[model samples]
Target: MLDFLKPPVLTIQEFFILAGRTIRSIPRRPHYLNDLLMQMDIIGVGSLPIVLLTGFFSGVVMGLQMSRALQTYGAVSQTGPIVAITLVREMGPVLTAVAAAGRNSSGIASELGSMKVTEQIDAMRALGTDPILKLVKPRFLATSFMLPCLTAIADFVGMIGGYIIAIGLLHLTSAEYWNGAYRALEYDDLAQGLIKPFIFGMVVSLVGCFYGLRTTGGTQGVGRATTQAVVVAIVWIFALNALITKIFVSR
Candidate 1:
């Protein structure tokens, strides 16, 4: 009983420790510029299609629902602004994080888990190289930097998607829809949208790294860690989303 209780506490401690180490190393020498850029490409470019698709569909559906609701009130034009604000403030960042958690988080965990089981990480240690510095930090920084970019893309794409529905299907005028959407957005909403994804990105990357580094039992352990990483990343994203939302919105 005591031992089982320890894993959760230990995991939390180690995860924070790894996060601290990652943060401290950011300004140090031998910066892995190439690796960081490569990870940015992989996490950013590689994840773009999914982010765009998620945003597009979400916006379209939101516009559809809002159109029906607003039409009864003779406010069909407001669909654009409503959809835009919701996407900009919530859906864009949260959905993108979820998708990335499902895709990239698992990929990172599985890759690192495989390395752990194969003793490749051990080889790095033997060579006097810090795996955390080379591997974890790059992924961590890449995800952190790329998520806002991805959220921006998702927000833009979501607005376009909403525009298509609002202008095309709902028969709302393009000018009215766009103007309303533009007017409805507050700088705070944009700020929150950007901030949420950056925070979620760290959650995804660090959780994956922590679980991956702790993998055991060969291939099975890798699979387990990958699954755990995705699940945990998603849970943390939602939990953090709520907390951050309250903090920002309340102020």
Candidate 2:
């Protein structure tokens, strides 16, 4: 009767166990800096184009939408500030993380899942090399470091997109738009913007690795793991965003 619940319960338990071990392993020796750098290139550099496009179009769309809404109140001039705040506080981090979850999470799962199914992971274990140390650590560190950088880039590019709409369509001055956008950000806003992506990065990488490491059933299981990694990472990203936002708002 409760068979359906067993998989989920077991998954949750194993996820925490993996997370705990990853965290503990951070301080231990046998650092794989080379692997970390390679992952940074893959996770950070490879994600640039998608992140750029997502940020730009999001800002453009936000400006268009907010313009109409604000025009009703004769506050169309405030579009820059509104766009800046919205992107920095919510859209930039969330969207970037989602893009990353979609791209990198699935990739991680597929790669690791393939390794597991083909017995590469088993081979590593037999050779006394910890798969978690070589694989998970690099990805986890890379994502955590790169996500905030990506969010910042996204935020800036988004502001530029909003600027185009503001100046070109709304007829606002450059000074007004830039000033409003710049002044709207406080330390708290900046903190939240960076913090959210960092946390989301950790979750994304870990979720991908978790599903990857547990993969079974050969090639079919690899596909399944890839799909699940993306879906689960996204769901957790949104959930964590809400919780973190609530905490920030309460303060």
Candidate 3:
């Protein structure tokens, strides 16, 4: 009985020790830098179109809804500023992070878990290659870099979407819309929104990689890890969003 208990405790300690070793090993591996670049392309570049589409539709919907609401008070002219401010301050980072979690978390978990199940990760260990440094560190770094870029793209596209809706659907002139939007928009809103996605990216990547590395058993374990990764990533994103909002907005 003591032996069994000791194994579990030892395993837990080993996991943390491995994680720390992995972190320290990152700078020594050049392959991880290459992998990190590839991951950035996959996680950031490949996901751009979807993020843009989502941002566009969200902006259109927000404009339509806000326009209707403001019309009742004869403030329809405020639509541009309202849509721009809301998108920059709230919708862009939040939506981009949610979309990224959906796209990347499950994929990361499944890929890493499959590698583990196939013993490829074990092979790397046998070869004296640190799997965590080669795999997880690159992914974490890639996510940290890419998520902010994705959010910036999303913010631009979302603003364009609002522009289209205001000009086409609401009969607002382009100049009028741009003018009001520029007047109300501040660098602070963009900075605030842009900062959140970087943190969200780190959270999503770390959780996904952590769960992936923890997978055991067989194919069923991989499936379970993938599902858990997405669920946990989303939950953490939302919780972090609230915490960040409170920190930034509670002023």
Candidate 4:
């Protein structure tokens, strides 16, 4: 029991150390603006298509499923508000973060793990450049900046998907669906939607960087780090989502 606790505790300590150094380096010299932009493009723009696809399908499914339930009370026409609130308050941010965790986390881990195994990180340190500064900082900043944007896009696309089902399948008028959706959202719901993604972005990026930097055993270690990064990032995303939602709901 104690042995198991030791590994986790040690890992947690190291993770926070990496996180601290990354944050501390942010305002320091030798800023990697180009790398930051590249990561933004990679983690942000590259994630757009998948985010759109998932958001749309999630809304479509929600509309279809909820209609069946609403039929019992003859409230099927209320599908827009239901879908909008669900997506904006919960589904959009969670799904978007999970997707980014799968995509960006694995990429970050694999890329950094490879660099670690090949001695590139070591070489950088030898050359007096900080790996945390050059590599981790940009990725962290980019993911934190972009995940919220992706979540917002996903929420909009999901609403559109809900609209399609409302008009096309449910035979509801466009005004009914759009108006219901627009009105259902409040400032609190919007705030919850945005905050979850920002926290998730930090968790995902930092977890990836942590596992990647600690990788060993050459190629096999890289593979292992990549897998761990995805799994851990996803787990943290779900766990954090639950915790955050609980706090918001309590308020």
Better of 2 and 3 by TM-score: 2
Per-residue C-alpha lDDT of model 4 across residues 67-171, encoded as one tens digit per residue: 789889999889989999999889999999999999999999999999999999999999999899999999999999999999999999998888888888889
Q: Write the per-residue lDDT of candidate 2 for residues 1-251, one digit (tens) a residue.
A: 99999989999999999999998889877899999999999999999999999999999999999889988999988898899999999999999999999999999999999999999999999998888899998999999999999999999999899999998889999999989888888999999999999999999999999999999999999999999999999999999999999999999
- After superposition, candidate 2 runs with Cα above 4 Å error: 1-3
State TM-scores per candidate. 0.97, 0.98, 0.88, 0.98
Q: Write the per-residue lDDT of candidate 1 for residues 25-49, one digit (tens) a residue.
A: 8887678899999999999999999
Off by over 4 Å in 4: none
Each candidate structure's count of clashing pairs: 0, 0, 0, 0
Candidate ranking (TM-score, best to worst)? 2, 4, 1, 3
Point out where model 1 deviates above 4 Å: 1-4
Residue 179 error for model 3, in Å?
2.1
Q: lDDT of candidate 3?
A: 0.84
User: Measured by C-alpha RMSD in angstroms, how accurate is candidate 2?
Assistant: 0.9
What stretches of model 3 exceed 4 Å from their correct place?
1-31
